[model samples]
Target chain A: MNTQVLSGKPLAALIQQRAQDEARVLENSGRHPVLAVVVATDDESTLWYVRSIERAAERLGIGCRIVDLGSEATEQVLASVLRDLSAEPSVNGIILQTPLPVGVKADSLVGLIAPEKDIDGANPLSLGRLAVGQHAFAPATAQAVVELLDHFDVPVAGRNVTVVGRSAVVGKPLALLLLERDATVTICHSKSGPLERHTQPADVVVVAAGRTGLLKGSHLSPETVVVDVGTNVLPDGSLVGDVDEASVTGVAAGLTPVPGGVGSVTTALLLLHTVEAARQQEPAQLAAAASAARI
Target chain B: MNTQVLSGKPLAALIQQRAQDEARVLENSGRHPVLAVVVATDDESTLWYVRSIERAAERLGIGCRIVDLGSEATEQVLASVLRDLSAEPSVNGIILQTPLPVGVKADSLVGLIAPEKDIDGANPLSLGRLAVGQHAFAPATAQAVVELLDHFDVPVAGRNVTVVGRSAVVGKPLALLLLERDATVTICHSKSGPLERHTQPADVVVVAAGRTGLLKGSHLSPETVVVDVGTNVLPDGSLVGDVDEASVTGVAAGLTPVPGGVGSVTTALLLLHTVEAARQQEPAQLAAAASAARI
Candidate 1:
């Protein structure tokens, strides 16, 4: 059986080009799209993700501001910094990074970020809006899976899809998004009875449970489209996805690799969301300026 | 094979009595809980629902004000009326009835209602909050299914539950609520392949597809707990649920009746939410008043 690899680099480059074009338009209109990423950790993987976002921002001609609060950053200080950025008119997008200081809850802190500037969807409110099918920014990883499928021309409508996660960030919102596209969705988590029972019958399977190699080829159909959203770091400092690639290499019709697939697309989508946020804020900014001038 | 009816009337009465107790406590504290319902059409079913809410409010000692915009109300007029009711300080709860006039959309207008008074979860924002596990009033009908299950001590955590329907008000929100209770949920809609394929494997099945008798006895596992949220009227001027009562009577272990099941529980939940909304609002009102007096 021959299998096709769904690489995300080409799609990410295509999206980055579009975002660059939109960023130029906004810049020419005197509205510079800026993304402020707040990192309160010293974790290597977290830093790597932050740097990737910076690189993607440069490609899109968007301004990237990385605020490193170090490992000792208190929740109070982080909240204040986020609130200040949210009120800053120049900051079009705000992202609160992971590996936050111990005892600091991410959602409660990120919820303080202005929704209009929340490009990464770290805020729970953004997830809620996505669930309700309202206009809100979706988490980059979840959106990446959908974008990858759409770019590959995979049929999602009326298909039985199993999403292996129940996270607020990925599994839950991704299920809602898939359901919006008319896909019959089943969400399975650790508590789910048998992963094989859900995955074997699904036409498409999306694994984002963060467990390394949790899904095996035996859990899939012969030609199922598998999109792995996991980025588990191995002990040898290598990255792996939730699906066992060796077992599923020939089993899946199309599969996304851990490093070159979802990761690349996620960074690109974040910049794209930044440009989109700028576009949404433009009209409101103009209206406010006009009102001020009149006053 | 003996079927037992999951009657919602007793549960509804019990909830109403609790709401009555809470309402009296608020009244004695010099704060009256008032629910303002906006009706934009003269549809028989819509009016019947409004009248039921009014009657329930009276029983609970809660004030009910129905704002009827009649049949010819435009979208602008309806929006204005709803906005007015939403801003009224005396009104503690706000609900907009369905079967709205032509060219008027329910969600866009109802979204203007303050989330504090959004008793029925008409707004997308309220639905979003519910999705995020935040404190927000959920749509009464969706909440009733869970309430019914909890009242009956039906186990949901780690159970395989199939939910039929995907309507924003019922199926979508109900699935989220059930998921919150740790139920591994499968959401099936019109696009889903077959009803039996999903229903046959579920430990619990919730049917809210609005089609009468959509779920059959053959679809059961003999002891599956069924919560039917459909309220379809029959030719004989009687109401029937989505489940065919006769077909499932001797097959299923537990089931809920049509008129006396989810409907009664829904009305009672609405009042319960109204009282909860009043409790949430009173603290803010008092704090604001105290600050003003101090100033």
Candidate 2:
């Protein structure tokens, strides 16, 4: 079977357009959507990701504030910043960029991000709300996988989806999202013995384990649609995903590329979430924005 | 295959003993562990369940407070009561019983329960904390499933576990608990067409769908161990589980009995949680209680 490449560029562009259009309506109603990206580390790759988000926010007509606290930042400092950002009426969304300095735990600080402004769904409250089928923002990366699958017209309801990994950010949340969509989801991790035992039987396989080339052709059936959520930076500075592209290409019916797959769509979704947060935070502005859209 | 009955009586007895011993120590320190059960409905079955809990608490030497708000209780009144209970220093654990009054959503009221006293884990914050592997109480029914399995020496890590339900109270939280134990867990619901498709491949199957005879012998392999979490009341006023015990008995390797299985363990776990909550809430009293235990 010839495998089809599920590129995320088209989906990203479509989402970016939606966000841009919504931002214009909000701006016309005198409400500007602002996203706060809190960075506590000077990691090169992390900085690059943050810059990309800023550029995307600018293009979408959303305000972007980069709060860069140096590597010597303490947990108390991070907590205070998050609390202040959460309370800031001007800030519509907040994203605490990963790769925190030593001794600073992200989990402890994320709870301070109010669920309303938690665009990336970093807050534990957001996750719990998501689990119980309540209104809450799901993590953008995890939502990206679902959005990408929907864009390509892949069915999820009652379909067997095996999410390989159990991280709170991706695997666990992704599973909950899939479950919400009525898809039978199985979560496999490091201790799951052989990957093929879970992957081969799945209608769709989502690899978010962060291990480069962790899944190969032998681990899937020909009918499998694979979504590669892994973005591993190699020694040569090139990026790859958990699924081995070379071997998985012809063996799987569909495969999402590492760079062009879940990553591109994730950034776009973040902007969409920001505009959504802005609209939700200001009910009067949201009404005006809706009227403006109807026009 | 000759099936072995996994009775919860033994585990419940053991846990009750532990709670009793802990309660005795706390009492000696002049601290009494108290559990407040807030009931909004006058449902007969719910009242019966509450009375059973009261009886169990009495046996364990834990104080039980039943706050009956009647069936006409409004959301505001319920919320106010929950908030007051959350603030009460005497109340170590809070349980808001189900079948809440008409027009009263439990989700909205549960959030008012402080996480420190949310022993039943009804609050979304508690559920979120559990998902992220933070310190929080899981719903006793969900936790009982794990404890019962452990008491019977069922190996969960690296095993295939098919949970037949998607409820917040049982299936969802239980899945998280099982995932934390490194089990490759699949959650199946009504949308999942055939029960056998998901349950047959599993080493262990947990049925919590609240449907009588939802899982039959045909849904399992000869080697499968089943945990029935259902407690459905029949028209004859007799209670049965999701599993068809008569049909599943001779086919499965092991099965948890309906009345004697997960249900029994659940009430016992709640008492244990109340005592544990009391110990955590009073630090100085906890230290003294610990010393008393040493004696």
Candidate 3:
């Protein structure tokens, strides 16, 4: 098998180095880049994800604040919290946790975010920005999808890339990013007819839909490279990807494991964007103000 | 050789009915939907397009004012004109001509139009609103492309739809609109490699590269329904679509022509959007206020 794993380790390392460089620049200024991570209705998965972000932020020398809310938090309550954070002078970025129990709409929660503080890009403003070629806090997971591929020296420009799924968080944004890089991208979803027809010829396949074995070997040719973005729980309570690992290992040229694939690179990307967001907030100016106050 | 023409004449007829119905609604409310057509250069194509819009508006009893500036109009001058139109009670919609002179940026021009007043869907705010599934004036051309496919009973839902092009006016916005329809959309552009690899299997293909005959019959399978958005002028002054009309006609099941396809549907769409924009504005409220003052 000519299969190669598309790893995010290298990109994470590069981003870490850049973060340290930026930290020094921020330290020279009086202020640091702060990301306020709001966690409401704490699920096990959310806890694990939050812990990782906390560790990553510490290692990167960036400020991280975890805001907790009750599971019964109303949309207004959550929105008010976000609005307060947005108004806070010290807070440079905001990341709101999703799946805020029953009755709360993700749509309404999204509009509450100040476009400038929305580092997670849950807001439509950010999505629209990317659509029009403006600078936006692209969904970290989506950015990681491409960053991982680029780190593996996978040539995306002019390649036939088929991305599965079209959520704002991944498939949709990734398509735009791929178009920006000049890749011919085709997006397929659960509704797409004859999935094999779209997958068989793909130079690169990114499967993000949370369905197990969605892309089997029969759907891919031996030359196809697969990046599975799904982190689905199997019947046995184990993690699985959208692409069937068994079929791809023997038939496809390359495959990324479900957990180690997109999931591994995602947290680091969140931190990377956070640090970049901080740096963009003018660390030098903050440092000067602090130094002046000290005198 | 089974290409059936996706005739816009029938589609235009259908849309004209909708436009006239909307016009009746506005006329009864004692408010005519008004569109302020702002033009700087008297480019032949621009003049022709403006005339078409004027004719459509006149037929619908919608008011249109041609804001003509000299060919050498500066960005500042044009922006100021748009700003005034945005504030004016009479102007319910605004259409800014593209290919702005040397000094004016299209992005800047779009920035000036109020989201409600932006009938052309040229503004960043409008584009952002569209991405998140909000009601915005989507670019008429992009909307027409999708509307044609949907109107023809071409099922976009769950189709492996590949769009080649990512221009702000056509490609990018169209991708977002298709995604909204639950179709798995992939966007390929000039940078996309082996473009045929993406096109060959697409259930639906939309080519809007602004280059003539970019998608050939050999590039697509017989089942692919092609919507050509290109309006390139041939060396001999003939207008052609991105797809070769003769080559794919027998092979592809459905194809749209260059001049008669998207172009014909576009002016009617521009008028439709203007009427919609006018309805959204409170022209009724204005007239009522004036009448109350007179009483």
Choose the strongest candidate by DockQ. Answer: 2
lDDT of 3 by residue, B269-293 (tens): 8888887877877756546534543
Q: Which ten-residue region of model 1 chain B has the weakest summed lDDT?
A: B286-295
Better of 1 and 2 by TM-score: 2
Ranking by lDDT: 2, 1, 3
List the DockQ of the predictions in order.
0.58, 0.72, 0.58
Best by TM-score: 2
- lDDT by residue for model 1 over A123-198, one digit each (tens)? 7667656666777898888889999999999988888889998887788788888999989889888888788988
On the 0 to 100 scale, the lDDT of residue A254 in model 3 is: 71
By TM-score, is 2 or 3 better?
Answer: 2
TM-score of each: 0.92, 0.96, 0.89
TM-score leaderboard ranking: 2, 1, 3
Can you write out model 2's per-residue Cα lDDT over B272-293, one digit (the tens) per residue? Answer: 9999999888766535434543
C-alpha root-mean-square deviation, each candidate = 3.0, 5.3, 4.6
lDDT of 1: 0.87
Error of 2 at A22 (Å): 0.9
Selected candidate, larger TM-score, 1 vs 3: 1
Candidate 1, residues B1-295, lDDT tens digits: the string is 7788999999999999999999999999988898998888888878987998998899889999999989999999988787666666678898888888987877578668878889998777677677777778889999999999999999998898899998888988888888888888889899887788889888899999999889999988878889999988898888888998889889877999988998899999889888888888866784563454354
